[model samples]
Target: MTRHKLGFWILTALVVGNMVGSGIFMLPRSLSEAASPAGVILAWLATGLGVLMLALVFGSLAVRKPELSGGPQIYAKELFREGSHGSRLAGFMSTWGYWVGNIAGFVAVITTFASYLSTFFPVLTSDKVWVDTGILTLKAGNVLTFIVCSLLLWGTHAICMKGMNGAGRLNFIATATKVVGFALFIIIALFAFQKSNIGPFLAPRTNDSGETLSLLSQVNAAAVGTLWAFIGVESAMVFAARARRKQDIRRATIAGLLISIVLYVGISILTMGLLTQHQLMASQNPLVDGITAVIGPIGGKLLAALGLISLLGSTIGWVLLSAEVPFQAAKLGVFLPSFSKENGKGMPKTSLWISNAVGQVLLLSTISGSISAAFDFIIYIATLAYLVPYLIASLYHIKLIWTGETFTTRKERVTEGMIAGLAALYSLWVIIAGTADLKTFLLGIVLIVSGILFYPLLFKKGKVRGTSN
Candidate 1:
């Protein structure tokens, strides 16, 4: 099969689309409860910087080894395979992490879409709505969740099935709409903010021990929770081989990342400034709340619709990248050979179908829960898997610099490598900070075990030769 024919616009969309998803629509309120408005802004800024660094590192690696198949996985495998001291197991784990992170990204978008719909329609947000039998007590806003999420999934698939051209066009519109939506949200919130709502910007409250604690802790928590907004900065690196110009990969990723940073930080600050900690914490969809408060009901609904579209775009782009990761890995002999198969559409049919199938399964299982709860669970587990690759990629950067092997411009190389190293450390820190429940952690272990068990099955029938598409 020929490699996917994505150009600069599609590549940029992938970066922007992947980074902008559900997080922008819902993260602000959750973050406001944890920290002050300033904390939320700082969190956005920090996450943006860390993730941008990741993109730069990945871009540098892609430029250096333009022919590699897997993203961070390829970099790690090459580092260890070419006589470096790194472990082959580390390379293997990195591949698994990247794959799992994409799955989490899927879950995040779907849940956020569901959360937004719940606002317009309300029964979907409650756990009891689904359990009470035949009461016909249709919650006013709940049905919208399932409807919107289904539409998003199918609509994205429809465009994607048309090939990369359709997806590229959709991505352009979706990315622009997403950024504008957030910008409008911020502008409205600022104009409508009430001085009363800004009360006690840093209030001191009594703790359980009758001691006072600063109100900013909540904002700190909010910042940490909202940090995942920047997680998809590596979107360009995954499909680097498909870009119009090899070097354009760095420019596209960096530009897209910076764009999202502006959107995320601006909206987050406005949201916190307009709503009290109690109001922000209690909000189901903070961005929507801020918009509704600033504009009118009509504006809120329009924003929700835009948010839904943005979520769909992110899902489509994420699914494409997620499916490609395994397919590319399989072609490189890092996964089962069956995954390398492609259909007449030039799609990695088997891989794409399997990835979609798994994502659907996740959606069905978690749709009944609180959107934020479901998101964190998926993200925490996925982060565990995704972090391994970041670390390996960062270490690879250090190795290259130490060996004095040139990749891109010397300035670019040094900057990319340093950023990669910092981002890697930050990724590890985030993973440690995430509080994954027992079920998710166990599920992760089971998946890892299954991967290890199936390793030899994929390698059977003699040595696998490198297959170039």
Candidate 2:
């Protein structure tokens, strides 16, 4: 049977939907807390260029190697090839890192979803309500939040199980809703913009004990905060196999990235202009808070509702992407074979369920913490996981350029090489920044090491097939 595939616009929406989720909703305050307004703008410009280069590299790979459709895993596997053991390890690690990142990302999505939902459903975000059953006690509000998150997770799984086309349509609607909602926000925010609120854009230095930071240092710090917003830029490449035209993958990736950048920078800048850095830092939901200050309480609620809808769409988009990575990798024997199994609708049933199961477990475990705390923990780890794949992919792109394997003209080659080099450097910087928190750094290391255990299973599978042959 012929399978239905996603077209250019739907693929673009997938990228946009996945990239614009929890990060943007919370990052305005985070960025303001980290740097001055000028520093924040510079950080966005730097991160934007870095991410755009990575996106372009992925798009170029889509065009140059259309048959390699599983994203980083395929890039590593093909570049390194079948005969090299180190190559196989690189391929497996790329796939594993991506899979881990997706699961962590999903947890962030659900936690953010519950957090926003709490604006309407107070119980989900309320302090833990203790319930005792003789010998045991449970946090009732936490348990309820867990149940809500689980239902959303599994419900999306069911939709995805039906087919990609159905999921894509749902994502398209969600993406459109969020984009329009944010556009309204930008328009309103601009009207509310106060010149004085920006306040000496570069921040003044006092002493070591003071809150002053150099512009360069501030930009560097802001880059780390903003990195999570762009985590799903590679979504189009991951689903390349399901694109109606291979060329659509390239177009969708670049277009989606540009759109996301504009929205991120515009909204964040306007948000800063509307609220003082001190006020923004104090705000739990900066966007909604800024809107409230301008329009009133009702406007805040409206934006909160819109934020929930946006997060819901993002969660759905990410679930599809998270499942696809391992499923596609398994098909190439880079992961356990079970992950490749699909239902009648051509969905990766086992992969989807397992990914959500992990996310569910993480969500339940973190229920004791505030939504912000849980989000911070999970997002940092997710950012760490994502950096591994990005770093490896950038390196592979550099290798291709060095080998003169990708471009036709000398100018194109030099330009592409420079871009790839800058992306590789950016990836390294982000990874270093992610590790600055020792606890998160150690936890990420442990997770990476744990993934190696599965390598033996793959090796065993290969040996059995060799004996059979």
Candidate 3:
């Protein structure tokens, strides 16, 4: 691949864009219903801490060896090269699992963009009165949804085909839109807040009604929801090779995470202040909806339209990032060689197509549902995909530090390693608690088994692509 001078800021922008997408715009209303307003705040705090730790872990590893590629794959290969074939297989499975998760995530984000678009144009969201079908029915919205999704998917595909520079420039713009949009939301909502809505805000509520016999358990569930909001925290880590400066990695990681936390907590407080619990819970797009209510119909629609742009920007970043995953893994010799190809412009041609294909499959599967449900399902899947790599990368850092590996001299190895190790542990806790569902658990298992089976076929070809230093 041709080396592009993609700076830390552009990379940071992608991280910001990916992290601040459809979730914050929509997840809060559902989260409010699941937990008390107080519980939601706690969730933000805990998830923020968890993400910070994970960032510290990756930061330490990046500092130690800037030569590594494929964030989790690099960590696994570095840690387990001395292990058996089965151990190696586990690493490969983990790498591919991460790829699957991100691809699913891309589809989810695009589907979400489609939903937000429907909000402004009801014609795009309305159901088809004519297609009275069986278990599966198509709507006019579905038609628009598919068309919009396909176009976005293909558009990103072409961008990736052009190379990292194109992707980076667009990511920068998207990231800026995201930051501005959130900031604008927070500022407007803060001044617009009514005193009545702000009172009794700490209404100690619960995340689930399944007899959570303890206060801590309830707190833990709220944390899980908050952690879900931070799902894209390590997004920039995957593109470690693309970072311009070594310190930039650490700086971007910390800055992006801190910004996301502030916005999350601030928005929550502002929204709660401006809207009654009843109003907030009742709203589908509470942040935007609240903004609209305050600003008027024109303002509401304008914010919603900005939201559509923000969502598209986010989806684009993820699609580019997701497309790079398998290609990165392939380059690192963790996946098949085909994924490692680059066009004349140094774009990961084959891998981009593969990512697009997977996203398309996910899009079609959920296209029949209401735009919201379809988008939610996609994001949920993407979150799981993101979690696996985070777990591996964090664990690898922890294992190295615990074992006292002498790979770095710039910082205290043991201190950094232990911090990273703990981050991994926290991430696992969050994943288990946050993604507790029969389907999600089953999907995780399926990804693991499938990766184990498929990687060996690629290995047998003896053309595996190794990582670029």
CA-only RMSD, every prediction: 4.0, 3.2, 2.7
lDDT (Cα atoms) of all candidates against the true structure = 0.68, 0.81, 0.71
In terms of lDDT, model 3 sits at: 0.71
Comparing candidate 2 with candidate 3, which one achieves the higher TM-score?
Answer: 2
Give per-residue CA lDDT, model 3, range 315-407, as digits (tens). 777877776777776666666778878889887788888878877887895456775566555555556666767887887776666676646
Candidate 1 per-residue C-alpha lDDT over 166-204 given as tens digits, one digit per residue, 9 for 90 to 100 = 666777787878878777776777687676775565654
Name the regions of candidate 3 deviating beyond 4 angstroms: 82-84, 198-217, 406-411, 465-469
Query: What is the lDDT, from 0 to 100, of the residue 286 in candidate 2?
Result: 80
TM-score of each: 0.85, 0.92, 0.91
Which tens-of-lDDT digit does each residue in 228-300 have in candidate 2?
8898999999998788888898899999998898889889999988788788877767888888889998998
Give Cα distance to truth, residue 7, candidate 1, Å.
2.3
Model 2 — which ten-residue stretch has the worst lDDT?
460-469
Which pairs clash in model 2? none
Give the Cα error of residue 325 in candidate 3, in Å: 1.5
Question: In model 3, what is the error at residue 87, expressed in angstroms?
Answer: 4.7
> Which candidate leads the pack in lDDT?
2
TM-score of candidate 1 against the unseen true structure: 0.85
